[model samples]
Target: MFNHPQAERKLEIQPNCIGDHVRRETVAAIEVSGDHAARSHIPKITALTLQCRGGYTLEAELGISPNGYAEPDYLGWEVKQYGVRDFVNYLAKSPVTLMTPEPTGGLYREQGVEAFLRRYGYPDKSGKPGRINFGGIYANGRDFHADTGLKLVLEGFDADKGKITNVDGQIALIDRDDVVAASWGFRGVIGHWNRKHAKAVYVPSLMRAPPPEYAYGARVELCEGTDVLLLLGALASGAIYYDPGMKMERADTPAPVTKRRSQFRVRHNDLTTLYQASVHENIDP
Candidate 1:
């Protein structure tokens, strides 16, 4: 909330609002309908049959794709990883200007976002008597990928202060069954944003293995550090807004670290506003 009539509209342009790119918080908030709910993985695979490759006839019969005999098997695909976005495509196309205003001297001066606003009049209030904080919007969009995905929920702890005994560079999150759970990488930081629906997020530097699709947890271990979920707040800790009615599969990664740490802190937006023809949230003021 700001006094300006256009401030709210500008904030909507941020990642938490609508755009072509994917964001976990936004995805969780959306009421996925029809084929989208059942088949979100189709975006990953396309044109396996018409690729013009010939070899294994048995692959097509056995439901495998050694050659270009059949279409991609969307059902057997892997989980979508983090940072697999086309954001750079948009940034590359954005215009660049030289007469951008330079911040006289302040935190804004170092970041250089003020220059853009002073150079190009923000979508509204042309040359208004104020500085535009463009970095806030940019950072919000970047965080969509920065602190997201299965890894976002992974946690780590201080070696000397926390209960990290194994120190073998990897650990499993499990109950009594001994089933392998979430995996933690070498060194990382688990950050939590200030939000009600937010989850404790793992800001890992290197994440190769992802949690199983629809899995509950993963046996998380790390070389740099580790952290386990607390019993008191465990059940509701990393509670994502996954639909109870949805046919969710058990996740593949481990979860002992964040069993009680909510991963996704989504701010549910009003879908009613989206349907309101006269009330435009993304109005170009």
Candidate 2:
């Protein structure tokens, strides 16, 4: 069982003390629970632990509710658990999903989702017709989309003007027709990242399973608002690359469109610059 000195305090957590208190309590709870058979899902594990120690219940999923405001979980701390096998040494192997908005302009915006899908959608790994979003390490004046025959030409990334632009002078998905299929503006992506960083408190956990699946909160990572600017700089330097997500098209439409969730992600080791504080080596199970 994990033992922490702070667990004995039982202090009533205030706003300023939330991060440290939550981390300590969460570690203590997981240590007390110990390992068990893999009888419950991950959400069930998180809910049970938080309810037992924090006195608040949360949804079993990893997202904010429609009516609910953002506060990591019920206690205003973001909880993230991952499989132990997925980590390498001290580094975790999980990609953070940055943004997933649809394209904003060009032929993609004009022709609509259906038309864009008809032209760009292809057979996925499962042999089903789907849209595959692609991103790579890009440089200025470099061919970021060589396979797709698309070029990267900067447009609005002026520091003085406070505007950012992608290679095409716009954030977009281009079709073989050379038309902008879908796009996101630099301002849009920046705003989203800013909001994400404001209340972000990362609770990293390691999970293991055999008969009883068990997980433990290993560390907590905190980020400040200034880290957002650092992240933006990383994106510009190609230290962080775009990783797009694929969704199957709905069957009800005459011409179905597979939605792609666009993301900008970096390696686990690279997170040091993006986060302000990291509390590690707290739990061992």
Candidate 3:
């Protein structure tokens, strides 16, 4: 729980225990809001609406602004909001996206995104014209996907040791001939994970829309003391999976549009496995 002193020390914040202060402030923000619905915080663009406003709304409550920094959100704590049907239930609506780092090596990096898509991608499932997508669930230890013909592989990670044996090693996708299709290096993946997820707070919320709004729940989860080794262990065991939504629009055109979405995800139940300690606190008054 947030008030537990042991939980605060789990982050190993020395001297003043800044993690404790952050936890207190987060709880205060939720408690102060009471039972009111938080309005969307998205900057208004005429006739534009974001379906995923729960996280944005909660960020607004905590006075967090959207940015591209690869670091914690508030006071060195990454604030993440997950949707739940009921606050009491706290059932996860979907898998949590851990990170979205593009392939730092392989054909995707050598030949560029368009070439990679043309070689390994398929026609858009939605039948969108001039669109090709490289999308699938590529889990560690799983065989090559029937559609993509790429198998997910972890290099230089020792399952027995549960550690990253090589910093240059990568989480990669390989074809039948062992051609590296796409890969995320150990440094890039671990750096991004450590910077933001070393200490994090996961908030569950209920969202509804007539005018578009969200209601954050009283139950909040705080996790701390995560390292690259633990993340690699999860990846090796297939607990975390590569689920990309990369696509190229206007494929036939000389200047086509490309969207690179390389995401690593894990089920909510598996989130605690990556952390040294996790506490679920009731932030209600």
Candidate 4:
């Protein structure tokens, strides 16, 4: 629980304005010296995956509830967590999974995810029988992925202007036969980013589990001034890349199980490049 009276005072004094309630709550959470249970209301965890529990646990501590919208997580701020070994030298060099937007156009959408997977996917590298997968790190100027035989392409954004030339522009995956394997449109992608991440915070955590638990670090990174144009420019320059993990299980069966995860990612060090300003502050202080 947080210091509610102080929060109430802040809210009363600054009605309709952004306040330090989130920061104060975050600091209060940091002061709770122990591991927390894996939890989140936004993405209610039916099964706790290794990569997901850290953020969920932190969200639980922050008292955030599920509100289904492409908007901020906390009082006007998107809260995200990244795992680290320790709080010391807390700037972990991990790739941040920015967003997982499904393809809006191309065979993936028009023909369906399963069809597109069978057409462009490779046999599961792990030798999981009757499984096929479509995944690779693809960026501008990169050649076709050897296994998947697909290359990434950006459609109508002019790199010189650092602005989208067409709202219909896309980040597309093209096959050898010139078929668009999958594509994400500019409008949806841009809207998702600008709305959810206009003001955002990244918290680092140390995690352990069988029953998952997490310990959040005091230091947090806050970023602001997000624009779709900055994201487009990063895609154009290869600083941000498309990395998908779409797969079909029991491919031989008529009703194959499918998992879809189309993601855009940037290095932790490169996070500031996507926003106008970014700063690190110790919540505990």
Candidate 5:
């Protein structure tokens, strides 16, 4: 379909590179539509970790190394700033914390151990040091500066009052009846971050099943007999615990709205590095 050799040569030329000949304009490879853009701004719960202090500071790498490796074997630092006087002031002032390093915002910060014990502790039981005084917080995903609105929905655990209606491929387009179609996505990797872990694609149909062309880059092996119930019943919503090799951990119940709103969480076993005692409660609204 070439009209002239010169025109064919024009086609052969690579995209303009520099100077006046260069094109100043460009188009985005990915264009986000209106509702999608709104979803991006609306924060969801990404992950939740217990904070064990009156109100402490949280740096990215906050933990003690059991073996004393060069770097901290433990990541996600937490501190408890609860002195007797600190507690007194905290009761009136709220949480006592270092404003500089800045605590992880959107944290659900429970009271100091003593105060929390008195508040939530049982009258019949009297155990001061046996894991009694545990308060907690549920942080919004945006609090971690994470990608808000993006939540990994487990199939079974995360659902609203209504049954999910439509599922298309890896994306579950659920019509909760209360709202328009909300999209849910699914992918199964080996643990959280183990790329070498015989990873395969597992996407249940949200609408019409995507053709084989859907699994382009990755290997796709169809599970011929997998029931739709299995996909529907898996965990859904909450924060995804990004434990390096294992990125998804399940967590707390989401606020029940229809549409596409969501949260993410990872499983407990996946978070091997988490200190068993770490905890916190969110500041009250």
Candidate 6:
């Protein structure tokens, strides 16, 4: 559906080192186009890259399945892209959905997704009975609640312990009645961290809406895996907030679904800790 001869040619060479070539070719594809540079109907940068490259394939073709395992986007390099209003302001938001299998021994987990929905499902703006996805800023020894009136208490955690202290002061989220509805154990978070494809090349793009289009290759950043560690630290420090995404109620199923996307988000300025090097350039009209 898209064509870029320059990028295709460059990709054909299949240089021994493909990471840098992908970056350069990506930039060229975006830069060469004038007003027509904007590609409507492509909502995400990943899709845009596939279109521009004109030949290279994505996750599947690269032998990476969704949520299967961590691997580089291509040639051992992970590519991430973000859109911004201007070069100065860019928000780095990633979904951290590890809260699954629920909590093995918690009351809510015992209740199961369907029962949980029946108890806490509230009408959304559209008045559809939507399951609540509970989230909040957490700190050591702080307390929070789920939509089903379940209370959760957080305690400072150590990697060795692999668990936190809940309201009863027992091991958190395990064998508890009034504990948090969901739990992200130390092992869970660490497991996610370990599987994450590190050494990413971040692409910041300038975007416009209505047609849902984008102009990418405005800037590129090289980030290390340690940045994810910093993100975890920020979570402990409360700089980042948990905002879980909820599954909308559907008539086809008996119960509404909860996506369990344990998203931790930071403000725009906070991105500096995640990136090591940055290069900015302007695209010509």
Please, what is the whole-model Cα lDDT of each candidate in the order they appear? 0.20, 0.43, 0.76, 0.73, 0.21, 0.40
- Residues 1-285 of candidate 4 have per-residue lDDT tens digits of 122211111111111212333223222222231333323333444323454656665565566764447778777778888867666877674688888777889998998998898888999988999999988899987999998899999999999988777889999999888899888888888789888988778877665566555555656787777788888888899999988888999999887999988888888888888987766765523
List candidate 5 stretches off by more than 4 Å: 1-59, 62-168, 171-173, 176-180, 187-261, 266-285
Candidate 3 stretches with Cα past 4 Å from truth are 1-48
Residues 1-285 of candidate 1: C-alpha lDDT, one tens digit per residue: 012211211111111322333222321111212112122332322212322111111122223343322122223211111111122221111111101112132222344332322332122224432322111111111222221111122223233343433333332122123322233222221111111102111100111122211110111111111123221012123221111011111222231111111121211121111111111122122
Q: Which digits, one per residue and each the tens of the lDDT, describe model 6 over residues 1-285?
A: 123211121111111223352233332232223333223432323433442221122222223333434444545556545544455544433322222223433444677654544554444544554334434443333454443344333344432443343322211331135445555554555444444534455554444433344444333555443444454555555455454444445523665455543344555455455444334333332
Give per-candidate clash totals.
Answer: 38, 14, 0, 0, 53, 1
Model 4 residue runs over 4 Å out of place are 1-51, 66-68
- Candidate 1 vs candidate 3: which has greater lDDT? 3
Which candidate, 1 or 6, has the higher lDDT?
A: 6
TM-score of 5: 0.17
- Per-residue error (Å), model 3, residue 47: 13
Q: Tell me how candidate 4 scores on lDDT.
A: 0.73
RMSD in angstroms, all models?
A: 26.1, 8.0, 6.5, 6.0, 25.5, 8.6
Candidate 6 off by > 4 Å: 1-68, 87-111, 119-121, 129-177, 225-229, 248-260, 274-285
The local lDDT score (0 to 100) that residue 280 gets in candidate 4 is 74
lDDT of 5 by residue, 1-285 (tens): 112211111111111222342232221111212121112333321111222321211111122222212221111112222222121121212222211110111111223223322333232234322233221222222222122112222332335642444332232211223121222233222111122111111111111112110000011111112222322332222222221111111111132111111222333222212111111211111
4 or 5: which has the higher lDDT? 4
| Angstrom error at residue 23, model 5 | 49
Candidate 4 similarity to native, TM-score: 0.83
Model 6 lDDT, residue 162, Cα: 33
Q: Give the local distance difference test score of model 6.
A: 0.40
Error of 2 at 282 (Å): 2.5
Candidate 5 vs candidate 6: the TM-score winner is: 6
Sorted on lDDT, highest at the top, how do the candidates line up?
Answer: 3, 4, 2, 6, 5, 1
